[model samples]
Target: MNIYAHFSSIIARHLAALVAAGELPAGLEGYGFTVEPPRDPSHGDLATNVAMVLAKPAGSNPRAIADKLAGLLRAEPDVTAVDVAGPGFINIRLRDDFIRARVPEILREGTDYGNSALGSGQKFNVEYVSANPTGPMHVGHCRGAVFGDALATLLVKAGYDVTREYYINDAGGQVDVLARSAFLRYREALGEDIGEIPQGFYPGDYLKDVGLALVAVFGRTIRAMDEAEWLPIVREFAIEAMMKMIRDDLLALGIKHDVFFSERSLHTDGRVQDALDALKAKGLIYTGVLEPPKGKTPEDWEPRPQTLFKATEFGDDVDRPVQKSDGSWTYFAGDMAYHYDKIQRGFSHMIDVFGADHGGYVKRMQAVVKALSGGEADLDVKIIQLVKLWKNGEPFKMSKRSGSFVTLRDVVDEVGKGVVRFIMLTRKNDAPLDFDFAKVTEQSRDNPVFYVQYAHARVMSVMRKAAEALPGVDLSDAALAGADLGRLIDGSEIALVKMLAYWPKLIESAAVAHEPHRVAFYLYDLASEFHGLWNKGNEDPSLRFLIDGDKDVTLARLALIRAVAVTVASGLAVLGVEPLDEMH
Candidate 1:
């Protein structure tokens, strides 16, 4: 399935054999070499730098090594010819039968063809879209949500046990503000003539239902209590209500997290204190007076005594404070506890997706994971950049739903979840993404998601047509696996198979890099090639997928097209997009 890996192993085995035969020096073992498709396809089908890597180690000239290696490699049954390219690089051309042999395997596997067992069952916890519970999710949260969810899917395909998580910032002052905002709505529900919402309070109408529910529950009797007494009761209720609306918005976009951890729980259960104590035991906690930031000093900046963490000892620019001068825990303190909680839950690898504005907070967080897990756990934070919405080639105006910034549901309603997820991943996480309604919804070749789906639909159309063109033939996968694939010897047909051969290797490399955007890129490239092949049939009748009299050739081409469709469906699954059977 992984031809690159297969050939790389082949080269390694040959290197060992050469050493055993005294051709290569004994100490030349463990030389690193890479096998990949040549950047220029004209060079060969597969190319490797094995000679260049082992020449110096073996104390032999690279050209001499390549000449001997080429002769041995040409003897492989899977390889048709071997040549030494410039500077002693070995390029091996696979036999057409070797490429065609994989077609039946792809047809039989369906979407499971590219699944890898690279992780060996290691656990990974990905935390993203941890939007504050003070309000509904806005468009700012869309990229992280899609990126993290897609990444979790990619990890699962790579054989890692993935748990998607969302961290709630409910214990902060923002939730207190939320409680007050709901109380104002509570008064509004009671028919009180409250004027316009004052400044420093959330003015959104999302809390109107919460107010009515509060009235229905306890009526006005609960309003007479002091603010201190009533704040806790309202805070608890508002958080639950806000989280429900947030969860609903996520569901609209087909995002669901396995865990929703609360920062409040850390305080209530003494986890924060325990985490700080753990750091102190390692001599990473300290008391100090910090200096002002170089250029971002607040107007009220002053050197004050505070409890700080030894963040600089691990790699941070400066030590970070864990507690304020008022003796209250800082947000970073809660964050440290959150990471500790993840390590305690037996997660050896963790990833946090943050907004681009949180870039300065990355190093310290990594330091926390290293300090708490004793360098055993690694935390990688992917900063998601801004997304600018566009329609009709102009900047999109306001959202009619919230009448302010666009909400995640607003975009989903405008374009379906498939378009939203696919377009969000069109660019890297740290790069700006342009979500254009006009371009994304277009049914032309320029639209990647649409083009990919159209390929799948086209494959279905051909299958139905092929059944009618070639009567009394078994076209099922089990039957096709036994077809005379040796008839598929066209250069274009062989090229398609070579592309499909890269899927398993692509999945493994992309998963290893923690870059899910690569999946979108691969799917786009695969679709482009398939579409080009589909168009070629209009000019060359022999290249067409179905033939009137040639049943054998037609069946072979149909098998090739089926493998393309199956591979596209498999790639789209990793991106969390459903491949359509038919497009309206």
Candidate 2:
């Protein structure tokens, strides 16, 4: 059970009672407040802002409301004490027995302990790492891939029916360059001496495999066709090959998408025209000339009259064009159709994960979702910042396989997949991250990945020692939960249990915020607490997890540490990371 949510309900009940007793004004049910841990643990266990929230509405000072609320809260069976702090905040300390009861609940649930039902199984779509189908994924795409995957996992844990999607940008000019690059490789494969790769074309030797594959399929016959006939076939073939490479890279990091939506399919199926017609029916489509944007003009900017979408009606800064002067659909038009298709598929909530470079694309895309869905759907875009790679205090080398940038495989190969995934989430999505090759792999407390995993491994080590020290004892979680937990009177032990009890509430907050980095931060803090308690045991034998010839206290301590292990494992699972039983 989520203790914070539990207390929130209790507070709401007391407020309702105050209204019924005529002590406070009516219609105060909608007051916004928070029931969370106090900033200073010594103040109390949990703090609430309800009195401050209801002060103005109740026509009284905050301290007066707090006194009335505190009086009612003190009568609760589980509340040890309640006090008014500062102007009006209520601080509550829960009974030790009440907090200890969560231990069995956690043991019974194991990794499923913190799962929440906040989403109510709503259909949610998360589109991320939709890199172009040109070559292998680079290190630049690694952060978004990991962030999106972790976010999708977090949403699923929050009980949402989520779809992890990847949109293949196969219809853009970049794929045409990929096909031409492969064509050059094909010529070289057939004993034709192709000169240096032309400027503005992909010069990566990675396309050599695509070239050789084409030769294996059609042999010399593909060479007979002209550019027009061969370009389409080559483009299709190249796109497929590149997607396979991209999929393999994702698989190395244990990521797989439910849908690989193609931009080409939207255009080929006439969905692009259908979406524009739908907008026209709503009177949001028009033909007009757009003024040159402020600052520098983009190469594709034009001042001529063109088909446009009335984006300003839905909160975009300005109207955006849907069709260009040459009568071709703009990139924005294809994106609009894609979202229109998503809405038709019954996803009312959508999230897009983009790199920092696409920060400007957020508003326009959100406007498209709002306009197309008639405001029935909502879209959230997360922008991931850049990751700077360093090695031995110097910049890391690039990969020749991916033309000039570091491939995702290079990073994954140097550090294991778990290290790569865990380290990527150590920062907020909008903040810059520095990834050091030596630091991330080091086996020290300074490395968050090792520190958190070591905490779990340390608990497992204690369990192993308990097995040998106290032979023939029932040590399973089920058996330990039935132990006499009243012996857990130590303050440090109770504090650890309280941390475990906070897991469910933490999951809900992180999922709602669309921030998976919070889980990483929480794991580090949890590890520190566990390690600190372990050190205290070395100084005082009474605080040790296993006591000589006292099975009751030993069992209680085992139950406590086991819950810590379960909680750490649960959090790591949410971040798409694995918890190790023993560290090398």
Candidate 3:
């Protein structure tokens, strides 16, 4: 029951009637208007700006159009009142009984209540957590991992065919450093006195296990090879081991990707050159000398001709380099081939979740998709901000096991997976978040995860008490839905129903904006409303879910609370959070 959509269609019909009657200008369909909940609830249940939106186009006064539209809405079913406010805003109020009647519909839908068909089965690719395959995943990667996973789940719920992917940065120079680090461990395993790790080497003890494994497989044969011969072999072995550790760590957090694309494969199979050749065909490839970058000059800056792509022709600030002066493919060339591969695989929409440090890379990547697909495809990039670690309000130190950064496993092992996932989403993707160990685990209303979970658990507790207090009373959802809901005359009861009805619209808007943190904010507000109603019953004994010797009233209140539970559970599922049935 999408109440917002229902009213929107009604308003559209009335506007069409005015257009046919010659009271308003024709071609009113071109005007874009919005139907949404009013910021102040006392204004009305739903408000529309259709009259204001069409006033300029139709060459008529806004209030006059609003007055005519209000009269038409007043004759509709269940619309009790319509008011034309300042500047021709139409606020429509529905009958309270009409809102109460939606409880049964919510009970039947359960967790599927807020499901939407906004995407209409369009294929979408969400690429995130593409961390370098050189060591274990750090706490910085945790934010992007959870954000991407939850966003993918939200798109799926909104009816998009989503593919969660992880891109491996194995072809970079970082992996070569990892290979050299593992070689040091390999020498130490062979009973040699390996001194302190040099300036550029990784110093984590985790590589000691990799060294031992290499000895088990290649034995003494690797010792006789030169640096050039052993670099590639050790690089391959080290990358595979590090990726396994990464996969295990992600599994601990309940994150699994559908695709793990290798950057090295793009170079090995000639896709990089193939992508450049395709650009050359479009006349976008050329030899040009770029000016010095903004601010200071780079160390490798030189005034020479380089192969470049016409990135500025699309939307980027300047043209980008596709090949360096040394006749080697640049990093941007690999990215173009990767996206071309995605375009070939039939994805019209793509979302990239990047770290905070990659802010400068957004414009060029978007330009690449637009140029390559000839405006047939679109790309959206979300930059995830950093997460600060705190223990009882003091900054936490880094983990020695990870050499320099705190591993994702250390955070998950300290608190469970659900807590980490929920807390990470409490802030928007572009805003920095502070994850404190002391505050998140506290059993209080200040803790949003616990507050929301307690609301679900409290409803379950109420059901248990209903079974004991009123024996053979049929406390199931079906029986509750069939109860005399007219007995629910309180303002709080009707407010909850309105909140529950807004779930479908919330899902649609959040999915459209590609913002998943809105779900966390909505859940917190819903839980607060439910908790407020529960506390109201504490003062007035008659407002409680279970009233002595009053079966009809008790069942009516039970239906109201059960509807709240269903909506909360449905929202949590979209955020990849499990609603708790009991608090420990």
Candidate 4:
């Protein structure tokens, strides 16, 4: 149960009653009223600023309103004490039994304890790792992939209908380069000695398998064909093979997208034209000259008029070109069409996760969506920063030309999926992350993944030991629901329960901010609390889970540990990292 929400609703109802009874003025909005844990535990179990928020509107002093609200709240069976704190803040101390009672509710809810409906069932589209399909994914793509997936899972927990999508850049010059690169590999597969990769061509050996497959399928059939004739066939084959590799690599890290949007499909069967027509109908699309871009305009730039969108009208720094002088659509043109298609498919909330190098593109993209939807659609672009690799305290270098670039598969293979996923998300998306192969694999407290997973594993160990020692003591809901949690009275025991109380609030806040790293940090804090309690038990016999002679006390303590385990499991699941039951 969400205790904060429960108390806020009760306080709001009482205030509304007061307003109706003429004790407080009408038309004073109470939407800003909130119930949150006090900074100091001694102050109260919860605090609310309702009196302060309503004071000016009600034509009353904050302290006066707080005193009146305090009296009203003190009458409730759950509220044991209420004090008017500094300048109208009301501090509430709930009956000890009220807080104790939540233990059973948590046991009943299990892993679903902190699930919330904060999103109100809104439909959201999350596009991440839309990395170009020219080659296998590298370490740089890992963070966004994990972050976006976890964010989608968090949104789902917050009751949003989330669609995880990957936009494939398959219709640009990059793809054409990919086609030519594959052709070289195709020649190499036919025993032709193609020397060092030519300039502007991909030099990785990842396409070797694709070329081998091409030889097996085409079997010299395209030898007599011109580049134009062979280009399409080879490009399609290479793209499919590369995407398969990408999907497999993502799978290795336990990531899967619900949708894979192909940029090429936007231009297929006139879809791009249709999208442009829709924008044109709204008078957002126009053919006009764009002024030379400020700050480092190309020296060879000529002031020729080109077709441009009025992006500046929607808050972009400058109007952006849709078509270039070569009569080809710019990259931004395809992106606009893609987003418009997403809007047409009924997603009013859209999120695009891009690399930090694309930071300058965020405003323009948001402008496009705003202009296209007439401000109805909301677009949030999260730019994930670069990942600096280190191994054994030395900078890890991966160069494609030297054939040493660390592929996604390499990292996954070295550390396994769980470590990779957890470590990737341990940092904020926009902050540069230093991922050391040595540090992450270490089973120490400093390693967050290890610490968190160790907490889960420790809980399981306690359960196993308890089950063996106390035969027939039910760990099931029916039994745990009847737990006498008042038996858990130690300071550390109560502190652990209080930490559990923050799960709902943490979930709501993290989801609201669209920050999955917050979840990672929360899990770290919770793990720290669990570890502290576990360490304390080593010193204080009463704090231990197995109170050797008392079944009720043992069961109560087990119930608390189980609650912690459930919350940890739920948080890790949201991050798509498997909760370990045993640490090896």
Residue lDDT tens for model 1, 1-584: 88999998888888888889988889765667889999999888899999999888888889999998998899999988899988999999998888998999999898998988988889999999999998778887988999999999999999999999999999999999989989998999999977988788877777888999999987997789899999999999999998999999999888999999999999999999999999999998888999888886577687889999999888899999999889999999999999999999999999999998999999999998999999999999999999998899899965544434678888888889998999899998999988888999999978989988998899999998888776788988768777789888778888888999999989888888889999999888888888888788888888898878887888788889889989999998888898898998
Against the true structure, candidate 4 has what lDDT?
A: 0.87
TM-score of each: 0.96, 0.97, 0.97, 0.96
After superposition, the stretches of candidate 1 with alpha carbons farther than 4 Å from their true spots are 25-32, 54-68, 296-300, 398-403
Query: Per-residue lDDT for 569 in model 4?
Result: 92
Local distance difference test values of all predictions, in order: 0.90, 0.93, 0.92, 0.87
Per-residue lDDT of candidate 4, residues 198-306 (tens digit): 9998888888888899999998988678999999999999999989989998999898999999999898857767766777787877777666566656775677766
**RMSD in angstroms, candidate 1?**
1.9
Lowest summed lDDT across 10 adjacent residues in model 3 is found at: 294-303
Query: Which prediction has more favorable TM-score, 3 or 4?
Result: 3
List where candidate 3 sits over 4 angstroms from the true fold.
297-301
Per-residue alpha-carbon lDDT of candidate 2 for residues 49-116, written as tens digits (9 for 90 to 100):
99999899888899999999899999999999999999899999999999999998899999998999
Q: Residue 212 in candidate 4 has what lDDT? A: 90
Error of 1 at 111 (Å): 0.6
**523: Cα error in model 4, Å:** 1.3
**lDDT (tens digit, per residue) of candidate 3 on 309-417:** 9999998999999899999888898899999889989998999999999999999999989888889999999999999999888998756587889999999998889
